[model samples]
Target: MKLPVLYTFRRCPYAMRARISMYYSKISYEHREILLKERPKKLYQLSPKGTVPVLNLPDGKVIDESLDIMKWSVSVNDPDSWYVNNIDHQLEIISINDKEFKKWLDRYKYHDRYPEYSVEYYRGKCEKILDNFEKILDSEKFLFSNNISLSDIALLPFVRQFSNVDIIWFRNRFINLSGWMDELIGMDIFQAMMKKFEIWNPFGKGEEVIFNN
Candidate 1:
């Protein structure tokens, strides 16, 4: 039998984290591209919450959250620094990303909704997270360690998106982060994961392909 499948939305930071884990762990699995506005029946059946980044395990287990999916994939083929074996500072970064950064990112990305404030004001709020991350990057090669850790992968996608709203301005303002983010995007893994697939009819497993080189 084939390995289980993962349903994901291409642009979602949450799904990007899960994909990064699977890619780094060298886990092979099928995939389904999902549209947030119109979720497929198959995915919704398994993921009652109707969120992307759902994992359907081979043993019939279903994982709905992105973090859960990430942990599961890493657990299966985890290398040296993954799992609880050698993890340090990964969890702390995750906490900051999920709790503090994610909160302001939502508002900053949709600045029009917060009409009371200028886009620059909200952008500054989001930039604070990037500034904090940039400081960490300035100190080391990765966010948590010299080597790329789960923390870096989990936060990179969101940071990538956070940087894109005003790419030229951001690049000029923070050249260090621009280079770092560019390096991440220049990778084959990120390029493959971010491709857009044409909308397809509702289908069963293996109908769609995952091109994670």
Candidate 2:
């Protein structure tokens, strides 16, 4: 039987991370495109934590967090490889991605909110993460393993968001890391999954748009 669907908002960094991981995992689901400003009752019911990228599992279980969704999907589809193979390494990268990188990313993206924080201060914090990554990326294709592992997949959406906050600066400063991104987004799965869809036009049963998977 098909799993109970995924409700996603296309442009959300959290949703983007979930979708990309789903793509990599070869997991397909009913894709309900939701408008964040007007989240559907079905999604609100599934996860009153009320976040985008909510996954309604077959047994009526729900996972509302993006990182949790990535872990769940990878555990099922890419287990013993992308994530499960090198457990400790996979964990360490996720720790930095969620904690250090995300903190700096948020501050950098919304420096206006943190009036006491200068863009340089936040950018410096974010740059430090990138610099650490550059050392690894300079040698391997991904952070955890040579191939695209859960660590790479998990950190990417946030990194993409963080870089875009100052595109020119990022592009110039991180020329070496361009290939790392190019390799991930270059996948047919990633490209096909990221396509923009129109607002809620709720599809009928069996009419779910599965993003070409």
Candidate 3:
């Protein structure tokens, strides 16, 4: 069978979430690790936006958005019920993470790039979203319930990025959120999702890497 092709950058949170979802769903695919500086011509051809975590289906359909990739993976096979409950609410939380929280997170992570605000100001903006997550997590193990769901997988990478900006600060506050992060980060699927691969060569003899195999 011709597996789906995934173009990914290791440290990109968007790619990370896509990998996490694929790994969790046990959907095997062709892993094509790419460098942002030297992106393959085919990647741009496949996705005009030229973003990482682009999924090229065997049938020629392409999924460029990371969240869409996650949704697609779960749609194929959701053994753990990742997409089974509270879908509307889950999408709402994911929207906050993607649209609102991501803006503040980018500013916070690269505070030097955005000189209009202090680092603390950016962090403060991020904390408002984190505080909401903490409140939800305080009552349950995962975002929506004790069991992990689509929202948890969708939001984990971004929250992990936010925590890494200043881990000590993150650990000092948000006890529930920190524990939740730790649990997800330590999972076998997460660890597998993070394994590094050689950069893919679109023109040369680059061996195919099977993700979630």
Instruction: Using TM-score, give the best candidate's number.
Output: 3
Ranking under TM-score, best-scoring first? Answer: 3, 2, 1
Off by over 4 Å in 3: 205-213
Local lDDT at 87 for model 2: 74
- Backbone collision tally, model 1: 0
Among residues 3 or more apart in sequence or in different chains, the pairs in candidate 1 whose N, CA or C atoms overlap within 3 Å are none
Global lDDT of each candidate: 0.77, 0.79, 0.90
Off by over 4 Å in 1: 80-88, 207-213
* Pairs with backbone N, CA or C atoms under 3 Å apart (clashes), candidate 2: none
List TM-score per model, in order.
0.88, 0.88, 0.95
- Candidate 2 residue-wise lDDT, 73-173, digit = tens: 88778733777667777778788888888888898889999989799999999888889888887778787667777778777788788768877888788
Worst 10 residues of 2 by lDDT: 204-213
TM-score of candidate 3 against the unseen true structure: 0.95
lDDT of 3 at 40: 92
Per-residue lDDT, model 2, residue 90, is 76
